[model samples]
Target: MKKLLVITVFLVAASAFLFGATYRIGLSLSTLNNPFFVTLRDGALQAAAGLGVEVIVADGRDNPAKQLGDIEDFVQQKLDLIVINPTDSDAIVTAVEEANKAGIPVITVDRGASGGMVIAHIASDNVAGGMMAGEYVAMLLGGKGNVVELEGIVGTSAARDRGEGFGAAISKYPDIKIVAKQVANFNRAEGLVVMENILQANPNIDAVFAHNDEMALGAIEAIKAAGLLDKIKVVGFDAIDDAVAAVNAGEMAATVAQQPFLMGQLAVVKAFEYLTIGTIYIPVDLQLVTSK
Candidate 1:
């Protein structure tokens, strides 16, 4: 009886190995505190289920060091693939290199690493999205307005590119002056505080452009507190549900919508493809969301 039991256990283990029970994927997200990122995580989880794989997720919590540590853990675990939503584009290079050294393919979602070999990068054209927002603001203001910019986290490509695009669009209208620009770190609370200070500094500002809806929403709060809501037009990115509702309510001017859910799903699909066939880079689309 003992011999028969041993034989059966051996057969079960062999079968499991032969059939390749599951593929392990490591997802390192920049932060899970925001609703947009939460949606992204859900999309990835759903895709992993459909592909019959398991995904282990780690949140960087918007810290570069934490993101690096998470990548190191993924590498040490010898995961089949690693997907990163970088907190800082340049800061993530070292982490990406380590993953490359481990021979584990890396895919960036929503944000790209400034250096190292990334097998695939999946995100929207942020520059174009920013340009769309800028143009909308210009038209609404009739090409002449004093605006304040609530920037995202520093050292991030998303912030840099979007700022560049906004600048390029507004340059055409010399009358559109950017009175003050400040970084809110893409946090709602920070946005509120920073915007409150900006309001005190520039009392007559006509418009505000925030890199993301979180910051924009915070700015709106500040505007309401100061009784400047009717005078100030706010534009934002991400088109998150709340932001969309704000637009419909005429509380916000417009927003450029980047599909975080789609980005997450595609990142997982590309990761699976890389494991099976090879590497591939995919660019997703961004849309302009407006009240009208």
Candidate 2:
């Protein structure tokens, strides 16, 4: 009887090994309202399906508190791994630390946590992309023009790093004075309202550089409303489909392109690799996209 039991146990173990374990991964996105993040989510879902792994996605709706709740829920579910696209770098640190304490590995995509144990980070060089946009704006205006700057969400890495890079690049051009600098919160509606106010204050603005395409598009509407579209050049980051179309239509000067879909796909692949073999880090590239 004992010999027969041992044989049955060995067969069960072998069968389990032959069929590969399915890892459960949690994907928490900052917001799905934005087209860029929606594409990212789709890419991740596609990769997970190919690998036969289960991915539970949570949308934070651009709320930091809600994002923290999502991470907590993922922890309570005992997921194999957690991937986060933080809304605010500082606000996400606490949630990441909680995941760390729970012994769940964490990976950050796009924005990073200010304090936490992250196995890997996947994103583009926002600073370089911002610098490119600033340089293009300067060239468009011949290095001497009144410019307006539209910033993204506050306390986010993308917003801070991109703003830093743009500031650094524009500092070299002494004559290119920034007449108005305001935060649009990366929302198109807010961008339009803020830009309309800025236009009223700075009537001689020659160019506008927005941290993201949504804001750039908003600024364009404001400029057009003011009947100054032909006079002012607009540059934006994140060459999303609509932004690229705007460039082609000659309504936008240029935009910096980042492969958000690839970032999402790689995040899933790297998470699987980390669970199986080891750790890995990837930095995606960026390029300038202009009307052709």
Residue 207 displacement (Å), model 2: 0.8
**lDDT of model 2 at position 174:** 100
Name the runs in model 1 displaced over 4 angstroms: 1-21, 281-292
lDDT of 2 by residue, 1-292 (tens): 2353234334433443466656899999999988889989987887677666789999999999999999999999999999999999999999999999999999999998899999989899999988998898889988999998999999999999999999999999999998899999888888899989988877899999999999999999999999999999999888999999999999999999988887787778778766654455332445899998
lDDT values for all models: 0.87, 0.87
Clashing pairs in 2: none
Lowest summed lDDT window (length 10), candidate 2: 1-10
Model 1 lDDT per residue over 181-279, tens place: 999999999999999999897789999999999999999999999999999999999999999999999999998998887777777766765665444
Q: Against the hidden reference, what TM-scores do the models get?
A: 0.89, 0.89
Q: Model 2: how far is 143 from its true place, Å?
A: 0.7
